[model samples]
Target: MVANQNSVVVVMIPLPLQGHLNQLLHLSRIISAHNVPVHFVCTTAHGRQVRLRLQGWNPNAVSTIFFHDLPIPPFACPPPNPNSTNKFPSHLQPLCEAATHLRDPVTSLLRKLSPTTKRLVIIHDSLMSTVVQDFISLPNAESYTFHSVSAFSTALYTSKKVGEQIRELIESKGVTEYDLSFDGCFTSDFKEFMSVQHEYAKLSSGRIYNTCRVIERPILELLETDARSRNKLLWALGPFNPLELKRKDDGPIQRCLNWLDKQASNSVIFVSFGTTTSFSLEQITEIAIGLEKSDQKFVWVVREADKGDVFNGNIIHVELPKGFEERVKDQGFVLREWAPQLDILVHPAVCGFMSHCGWNSCVESMSMGVPIAAWPMHSDQPNNAFLVTNILKIGILVKDWCRREEVVMSAAVENAVRTLMGTNEGEEMRERAVSLGQEIRKYVLGNGVTQTEVGSFIAHITR
Candidate 1:
């Protein structure tokens, strides 16, 4: 299944974090299925993480997709501060800095692969553009910047008012020269990281979004009309995780799914913040009390946030309230590690999600027709919460962004859980969520928008 000498080849350079790596890996499978050879490049450690944790399709079976592992020098890996007043996960800043040192290895690999192909297409995460910038000058190498966030957040972030506010906030904290903004979520170093990315993105020949027109038409339209995006070849090819891939899980995962099978239809709520959100022990106690008081059937994933290196091999201890798990044993199930999120979302008994509104989780919840209790924690999360609660009308806000620094009281969590799972308003939101999911399905699964856009991208690369 290797490409012939004259065939177009694609190389993927994804940011080493979970969310970013997952999207580009999915895209690689899509492109490889069309007979294009794709080389997925990353550090040796992250490459192992990708292969071990990849859920649906088997990467080994995909002959056209190859793995290229590059080595970089060791850097410090710090754990995220669970109680930090600034909501951003600033501890991840060092990882981005470490990735920049890959420039030499990446450049060498690209040059070696360039001469054998008709075209060498480099599809890199928008934030990882610095790693590939030097090789874009090769005669046969063409690059596209792949944006992993939602279209709504991206558009809102680029607006004048939001941009200025973020700049002032960062500068007040001693940052001086970053161009992109995420409103108080990024630290000085993170701003510098983004500044580098923004500069290199201008060199890309096209832009790719992990979004579709159905759910984000207005936002996508806005981006298309924006001056920065004008005249660039834009493609919306997403809802990327295989919607219908049958997964086989055993042990704890199987038991979790079995528990879901026994619950009444639409009677359970799924509670989890993505990997990067951690709460103090006091906050965890409040969340426990809240869910218990709501008296709702639930499955909650409890784990500490990731360190700067996701594979740092050091585990931080995270504990629930003493005797609390025993008290709610009949009413709730608590999973202590990475739960199979998509499987639980698609289950019949799960009715709502209490989430951090991370973009990947938001997309998965929307695609599954599950309403959300939006508890935004940082980065694009507040904007995503607004999109879910205000724009999509498929969710309820659990925490106001203005009060994000305060611990959310148990009463507030209880009210939000009850409102999203037990009220008539919740039912109405469920209906709308289902309807939206159906419309999105038509585009991503049927022969509609996503198919056409993906086909166009392949045609562009091969033509």
Candidate 2:
């Protein structure tokens, strides 16, 4: 597990959010499986969080991967506002600001590793490019930008003449302009932050996406045009988080899995939003009512919104409608703890997902052949939802992006659940999803396009 002085090593730097951290950690496992030494660098608290919440693989046992938990100055970690008109999780801006302080520690780590290793290869989340900006000065060090979002979403930001190009792309696929909207996704400050990250990516040695040609051939082709036109490097070696085993412990996640055993095939809908989302109490009540009225079996995973620091030892509380759990005891399961999403999605009883369309969730659902009711919150989610519902036709939009500010009433929620779970149209989408999932799984195996891409990346880095 220990690297020798002459070994080539990879250092991973991820944005401190759950989705970002999860992707990079999964990437670390992939790279390490190939006999490469990987140093995963992050804030101390976030490093602990990533390890504790990691599913598939045990971080402590991964000797080839090292955790460099650097300290960052404290900053405000405000809870997200679901009622805010702005769809973005702008509340996490303070964490973004604090991440800048990692510049010094990161730079020092690079310098220390430079003389000892044959080469220091840095794979960083595109947004964290600023923290590793100084890597250019080291002759033996090269950095690649890892995009956690899908290639489809990345193209919207990277393509030149963005509006015209995207219009043509969408229209070519038979999508209506009104089908996709980003009316209030990002505020000016957040836009500036993203612009800086996209610009910083230009300075990296290559671009790496958690995508494969099977899922986003056209989008990947578009990115290649840009990367090749500029003579920049690019690779699509993904469908990360590949494992699917359920946890063995008798925890809430396992209990949820056990409950799925008794349900009929394709009879349950699994509803969960990613970690960054926080709904207002009223909205939470509406969701409870909606699920109850839908008259379908369901498993809803609910958690308290993050308050700046999830590690601050404060008791987390998320209130539901009074007696809601008791009322739905026979018909539904309300899981208040962390649920193993892949395990749940792969279950025979679970047929559909009501999700925020975060790219991670998008990939997982499609990979498991589970259809989605897309209710995107912000960021690349709206665009990702558009991809699922409009282009691929593997999912349904639960709510349009323009209506994000309004509280989606229980009636609307009930309708979406019914449409995705109880209708023949939903069955057709599920059939398509199953076919697509089979293709994805195929490509990630021997001699497949995704595995080939992974091989190419390893050969490039280790050669």
Candidate 3:
């Protein structure tokens, strides 16, 4: 898929996180597949990890795609100490600081490109909206912010009426289970980040979301009609998951598959909280006890406390409850490092998922016909959990609020796990998930909603 001399050149700036990078990379692949040249920008560390993760990929197949690495800038706060018990507060400040520093390097790279031959378009993560200003300042270049979360979450953030109501609710009382919408779920740090992001988004020409209009039609309509967002051009172009691509299984993946082969259909639950979510020691103990008491077969991916550290290429040493592994040895498998998540989801034995409700995990679970046990941790996850459990009615909520310190009791966990794995409600949810999964695959693969939107987006940017 080589681009001609006069073809559009897309510059993608992804926030340095596993989920954000994955979404942007998939979007870049879609654009490159359309014969558009893409320059994927990231820090040196992230770029190296991206290259290693996609090592088996044949670059010659996608001749129009390229990666540009920028040196990581120093942050005011030192990196989290490995031995620290408290979780890293937030990754936004450091990421924003780095993006601020990259303005010069990124601008220099753009200036060096042949302007006449390359019609430029910048698509960047919403979190890194600060960097897009520099790129869009270039002559003949258009800019669009790419939101990796759901349109519902975005609408709540952008709507003035909704924002006011949420603020009032928060001021009166903290987030509660009854108030499960985005306004009710945001953490203080996340609220500040969204405030900055929403302001920065005004600088972009438009916005693009990795979602399908069919899945989020009401919210999309609301956003379009809202005073704040009505004038802004928006497009929903996903359910985009590259994991849908078929590949040969490696040693670890094969082992997971082999284990699944022995289990009964719809008997196993797949548990993970994406790459960056980490639980406190007490929380992990409750989860362990809950899983053991539920008497269900499970596969759990356990990462360390340092949420910001990714792709270290070393197995994480997570400390579980005393003799916990031995106690659940016959009933569960604990993956202390990364596992092939997509592989596990598609297996017949994995009937349900225990997830943090990140958009990627939600989309993946729904796409695979696996119902979810929505355990939202932070950021947009609480909103996503509401979408899955309340709006879609395809999963059950594990917890109602976003407080990480409030340890969820083992009894609550046990009940949620049982509801997802064995109860009649769980069966109904599984049926709905399977039906929705078919619709999602149809929309993303065929000449469906996502395909049409992606086409329109490319045409708009190119023009």
Candidate 4:
């Protein structure tokens, strides 16, 4: 039998989707840079995507970073229902089943590695944690539960008491079965849930947030309390290697830097609904008018249509306002179908993000210290938007929610975009963002998995 001979730590990253993969790749690079031998555990299909995207260079100086593909059936999450946004389709019901099936693949892979002494870091999706039934049972290993979102996001996952009360009264169609909406979900009924979550956080050995100190001050405070009680590490590490990002430069990168050069520094408003989360045509019209009215120089990423049916009113995430692109072409005040997000966000000309609040985008934007115009689409997005608005105090929300759906009228968009674009408050918010960005950079490059902080973190788990 081939025994596991390598000594450097191995992190099994189960990256199911785009966001999940990016977060893991970022951390894997960080660890590999510090002399740790790292392997990104990708499914065969995903591994193919990685190879295509990454031109292939070593992640760090010494260690060789490679993709380890585990042959597993593609997970059966429901395709985004082309029919409507009003409800989640039944296709998604299989996610629970897929997550369950994944457990064995991960376990089998762990057992296949014969190095009994080597430590493991499973930098996978938070959703994958559901099937990670046992961690201590594995060979020398520690887990770090890294959220692609900010710490502020975790807090907002629970609605301020008021929203919960409203939900109780309203009794919406889907309200009965699910947990609380951003509107609210607080109850003594959650004792067991909280207990289990806290347990996992402790068992994790370390809890990492892809965020900065300024916006996440409160969430980290709460996390520290929880970690200290459980004696775990709480690391706020973010903006991890945007400029020097590599090991995957082969992907088609949007030439967004040239666009930024022509725009005024801190004057452009960047909008994107993430790789997923297409908007309805109605929603796009409203937003376009808003950008026009606000007189903001902006760039919004849209997606091409898939299937004949309208995913969201025939508009993909890449679609833009009709004729507006032509009108604002000179001012650079239009949108792109897709742009290199991190490259654009870090650019001096880019100022604020008008986002759907996907966890990855949220953290990346926050870490850049650019304020956000939160436009939550679904699931944890509303939760993320809440954090961007209330906890971070860096975001000025666009009053776009209507009957629980985004009602982004042009006027509303104008107000929110312009407010975030520039003003005394906006300037202060930008500075606060920059300050927070600095703190995040400090932790990421300061001492990642190699140092005493993360080393102690690994030690706690190995024992």
Highest TM-score: which candidate? Answer: 2
The true-versus-predicted C-alpha distance at residue 142 of model 3, in Å, is 0.3
lDDT of 4 by residue, 1-463 (tens): 1275445356555534556566767666656655566767766655554444332234434355766776655454434553355422234334323434656776766665535445566654455554444656876666777766556545445224434433443344233533334442222333333344444544566666665454555456666776676676677655443534332232334345666777777888887876555456677778777777787787766663222111224443445556777887765544344445777787788889888777878778766778888876555676677656654567876753344443567888888887787578887777777776666655555664235445554444344
TM-score versus the correct structure, for each prediction? 0.92, 0.95, 0.87, 0.76
Off by over 4 Å in 1: 1-3, 159-182, 227-230
Give the winner by lDDT: 2
- The 10-residue segment with the lowest total lDDT in model 1: 161-170
Candidate 1 per-residue C-alpha lDDT over 1-463 given as tens digits, one digit per residue, 9 for 90 to 100: 3345857989899988877888889899989999899999998888877676676688999999999988878888777788887867777777778888878988998998898888889999989888899865799889999988887677656556444443454467565633343566667778778878978988888788887887777666556655354567778888777777575767467877887888999999999998788898889999999999999999999988766666667677688888988998778889877776888898889999999998888888898889999998888888788778876899998988877789999999999999989999999999999888888878788899545889999999998
Q: What is the C-alpha RMSD, rounded to one decimal, of candidate 3?
A: 4.4
* 3 against 4, candidate with superior TM-score: 3
Residue 75, candidate 1: C-alpha displacement in angstroms: 0.8
- How close is each model in CA RMSD to the real structure? 5.2, 2.1, 4.4, 7.1
**Predicted structure 3: lDDT:** 0.74
Evaluate residue 401 in candidate 3 and report its C-alpha lDDT on the 0 to 100 scale. 66
lDDT-better candidate, 1 vs 2: 2
The models' CA-based lDDT, in order, is 0.83, 0.84, 0.74, 0.59
Error of 4 at 179 (Å): 14
lDDT of 3 by residue, 329-446 (tens): 7799888656657778988889999998889888788878899999887667887887788778899988766454467889988898999999999999999999988888887777
